[model samples]
Target chain A: MEPRPTAVRPPIHLRIADDIRMQIERGELPPGAAIPTLAEISERWSCGMNSARGAVALLRAQGLITSGRGKAPVVRIPPRRVIRSSERHQIEKDLALKPEAERGAIGEAETNLNMSIGAQRFSSQYDQVEAGPELAKVFGVEPTTLMLRRQWEATDPNTELRLSWSVSHIPLDIVKSNPALLDPNNEPWPGGTQHQLSTVGVEIMKMVDEVTARMPTTVEAQLWGLPEGVPLIFCRRISIDGDGRVIETSDADYPADRTELHFVTPLRPWPKRRQA
Target chain B: MEPRPTAVRPPIHLRIADDIRMQIERGELPPGAAIPTLAEISERWSCGMNSARGAVALLRAQGLITSGRGKAPVVRIPPRRVIRSSERHQIEKDLALKPEAERGAIGEAETNLNMSIGAQRFSSQYDQVEAGPELAKVFGVEPTTLMLRRQWEATDPNTELRLSWSVSHIPLDIVKSNPALLDPNNEPWPGGTQHQLSTVGVEIMKMVDEVTARMPTTVEAQLWGLPEGVPLIFCRRISIDGDGRVIETSDADYPADRTELHFVTPLRPWPKRRQA
Candidate 1:
């Protein structure tokens, strides 16, 4: 009896996907370039249409391409990550005394160091809600006290993909000193949050940042265009005033793979007697 | 020109997926419980086989389910995050002279407190490699000098999912004082890395942690079992000895969704002036 032929091992779908991946990496499939149709892929790879479709799905999962109902898959070009460092805490504190142009140049919102205003859509929402238990504890306020909640998000208009997101909360009584603080139109606030609080006579003497990370949900993944195995960075910034009263709290999420969080900690000199 | 009945808006696939998601959240599908098979799902949801398959795939991508060839998908149980804080630096420094059992309970690895040993697999690899240019500058060593490298990882054995991961590097010449330090078997060393360096006549006077976050790639997402929209927390820790010489550097990654990075910065009181 003739020995059964070994199963033909090289999966056609994987081979096709590899070829496209290589092309993308080599710049043959530049960002925004249309990917081949299922029929075209099948003919090019000499494989079944299902195999071609599978290859396209593989590429999409790898964040190499994107597809929709009427559109062909296209190479995905991710935006540059913005670096928000804890070192900037001190820098922002110092910059508060500077002129508008100077402060704007060194602003926290100026995450783009190259000074290029890339094409991105930004939206800010403002609302007044009672602080939740967790947030109340951080802000040293009653859970029922009204607080101003501001949420901001920037998206890539072409893909409707989120680029950056953050939420800030301040006790209404604290920011009511400057009614402008309650307006979303006043966003992109010059000098950022610190300056906004300053207008209300709140001086943030100290800032503490708590950070953590976790996996994203399916819906979140689509919003951020995140690939599997990547975690999200969660940061909560707590600000305190001169009397050790918690004044403001803000929480933000960042994609871990592309973003870099920097923290600068300065140490005091050891006592002369204790020096070795 | 009837607008084609609005294209029959609803799809069988989305309906099936949403129903399963609701079931999972409602605890009908408990952690580790097998998810319905494509055939079963097709019958239960009154959808086609392909739609059933799509539903399962959606759940897997959301991190709610895990599947393998020939096996039914199962609900995924989220793992508890171990909290490793910068405060461990001061804790270890103060506990150096304490007894073994006491020291072990308070050192760096103590963060694994609530974790089940059987649920997670821990591995450490030790190697000696030449210091790269970037590391050489920080360690004040020549690029040609060998440096000891230790990598630690904790993963879910069944799913092969990473829970925690970190890498530490030290100049070989500095740690060579204790031969046991070169052995991977000596890991989980009592008193942690600080004590290990002490055996080599190195005294860490300061430590710095730099942190950031970004989106994860496809490969990274799978390894960490991350969902979409999640960010990753990146931390690089540098240790400096008495002479302000950089002695060790370690890098760690954390999933932002489930992990929290806490840093405590201690401030010293201002010096009192002597009476004239």
Candidate 2:
């Protein structure tokens, strides 16, 4: 199909930005390589200094390059992405029954993080609070019902940057009998929440993860040490018991630049009647 | 646990912004309601006009409110999110076996879009291209291998705004036998790619979705008419055949403000020996 002509061409700044973007995608401008200076860009594109500056600003907003005071713009060095897979849910369940000696050798943190466990600072806080309206609706409980809230955080020991953080909530009535379940010191549990639930004779048969993304608040950005244009991925995982009751919900955030969530799904065979 | 006292308090602008955010979250300031004017905010917070302006800017950067050149800022009205669940892979496979009349009633676009099918304009473009280095590596094929690329888009007819878009690729050697598979006119093909591949004796048994996010470029923002601070969610779906070969790959983008991806995993029960 022939292309339709437009009334006006794209602005000079956009053309320059697009050209630079193509170079980056082609690997001609690799990561950590400084971009062309403003003078060079203006001469090459035959545009003014303002156009060259606009082009640089456009690239920064798209997260393709980084610019700071007294520094040349460089292709952004993308962070190493850690893959978080849904397959771990079943693995954790199976490990819950393993011998303590073998299970103790492997913690979920060690499996998920690239750094040594000793280099990270971990904290857990547990409290009993009334179920708020949002959580109460999910749990199908009264608004004033007691719920156990657990907050966990792992930070880099030297830089104090947040490595991982999450909050988990469970109905207090379900796990009250298991005193170990309410203790924060019991964290780094061998098999994670699945094993904790098993102690109460509750088994999680299904896990649902709902994923979304948003710009982080000012405080959150400060805590995560996020870059200027990055967003945060928000994931809420809900566990369901065998009898179809919602047992627990955990909410976590991952910096969008350095995390990838992988989900594997197996499909049923197509019916023979429609086989061509 | 009590929070320890800090050496210094947060800036006045942050306090003002936090208070307004609390009001929005508490429903005291509903969506689309005009935020306090600069004069009003200054008086209420006992701060200068610049501080009040800074507070509003903070809210805009966090995507909590909207501010334009001359208009007062208002609480952002969130778009309605459409949930796309991983379960649809099986649902599509099941639909492939149904009769044409029943299958025509549902399309992939209808399942993912918020608008009626009749109100949207759908287009599909088919082309033959060489598998590039990145794609060739994924397919474990030679770089010169011919691949069929299909671009699909659904747009609002009246506004020409993009509703949904995706690009899919399959090795041409695998599907060249069925001429119908290479034609764009054959789209709206009942049951989508799953059914089309079924005709070629290729059954997709497993699907892997890799999810990440980043800021959109200028062209994308213009096409989607997105607000100032929204990000784009990137998802790559890889389909594996019965032989465990990656057969098809599709790349999709969704506006972070109005899309939720849901994945459901059913875990296998522990061995009988471990069942307590």
Candidate 3:
């Protein structure tokens, strides 16, 4: 279909922004290089200073450039993010019987190395609640049954804004066997969820992560210290045991700019073909 | 770590905004319900009108509420998005051999149900370029060899903003056997990419989608009409043929609020134990 006439006339600022963006992508203006000032762009592009400023603003919003009050805009060099692959599930399962020192030395949690927890305010809330229809289906239990919900959050000490957050749900009946599981102080469970489940006779044989993305609420944005145009990655991980029972469901969110989720699928070798 | 007090306490508006946000999450105010007016909020919360207005503005920017002139802000209900599963690769392969009429009836484009192609401006550009070092490694071809790069975008009819964007790359030599493959007009090709490649004796045996999320820059926010704190989902899909040769690479971007990606992994049945 032909485009609507209203969409045909690209705005002046957008056209200007696209030109500068192309130059950056083509490496004519390299990362960390200062872009032309509004006055310079106005003179070169025969546009008003406001239009030039708008172009710069547009570029900054797209994360192509960075600028502060009274500072010239410059191309941004994004930091490298570590990839946390789902394949780690298999590795964690194999490490269940290993000593704590050996497990700690693996350095899996420290691998990506984005934010440091030491500089944040951490909180954990533990509560028992009836499972909703969604959780009940996953847990293979009645909706009225009580489930344990643990919420964890870390706020930036300086801004008092949220840095990270996650919530995990487990059947109350299973984890109640160990009273420590209900204690908020017992968090950061040394070996992570795998070890926590092992204490409850749950051997997780498989895990599936469903991933999506969405705009954060106003309160969420402030907590995450997110910039404009950035989205949050939402993942729901379902863990199943050897008996095929769903053991737990954990939901986590990551800021898109600083998080990369990787999934590695190792294929089984095809059976050898019979000789003709 | 404890949160440090701010030198200038955040304005009352921010505190009020946070409180209202909590109310929404607690189910006091449900999605799609009208938010209280500035006057009402100011009176109820014992805050100034400016603070109330600021809180509403913050909610709108965060995508929690939607409003316009003369319209009171209402809680936003995110639209339901279609989940595109990777397991469809095998299904698509089987459908490729069907008659063109049957294939056209099945329509692969239906996957994007919430995004209407007719409501936006569409653009597609095709170019022949030498494979860069990274792409050359995947294609197992010389860097000097030509590759076809295709970029597509849909812009909103009213705002002239980006709605959907993607780019695909294929070795020119592999697809050039069919001249039509070079034409952008043939997009939404019956049976999708697999069928298009089949014309050249290329059968995609496997496909992998690498997914990540990040915040968008200022310009991207405007283009996608993303609210503050929204993240974008980035996915790179790699297609490999029976010979284990990478045939095509396609990258797609989806607005976080309206995209869900599903992946299914089928496990092989365990081999029978050897007779004792």
DockQ metric for all predictions? 0.26, 0.63, 0.26
Best by DockQ: 2
Q: After aligning candidate 2 to the native by TM-score, how far in Å is the CA of B211 from where it should be?
A: 0.6
TM-score (0 to 1) of chain B, per candidate?
Answer: 0.67, 0.90, 0.77
What digit string (tens of lDDT, one per residue) describes model 2 on residues B51-155?
Answer: 999999889867889856688889999999999999998898777777777777897887788998888998889999999898999899999999999999989
Cα lDDT tens digits for candidate 3, B154-251: 77667777867888999998999899999988876777777788789776767767788765654676678776546678988888877788888888
- For model 2, how does the per-residue alpha-carbon lDDT over A80-160 read when each residue is reduced to its tens digit? 899999998888888788777767788888867667788899999999999989999988999999999999999997767
- Candidate 2 residues lying further than 4 Å off, grouped into runs, are A1-16, A38-54, A67-69, A271-276, B1-19, B41-54, B67-69
Q: Is the docking of candidate 1 incorrect, acceptable, medium or high quality?
A: acceptable
Q: Taking candidate 1, what TM-score does its chain B reach relative to the real chain B?
A: 0.67
For candidate 1, the share of real interface contacts preserved is 0.35
RMSD of 1: 8.0
- Model-by-model lDDT, in order? 0.72, 0.88, 0.74
TM-score of 2: 0.92
Provide fnat values for all models in the order shown.
Answer: 0.35, 0.78, 0.35
- Number of the predicted model whose TM-score against the real structure is largest: 2
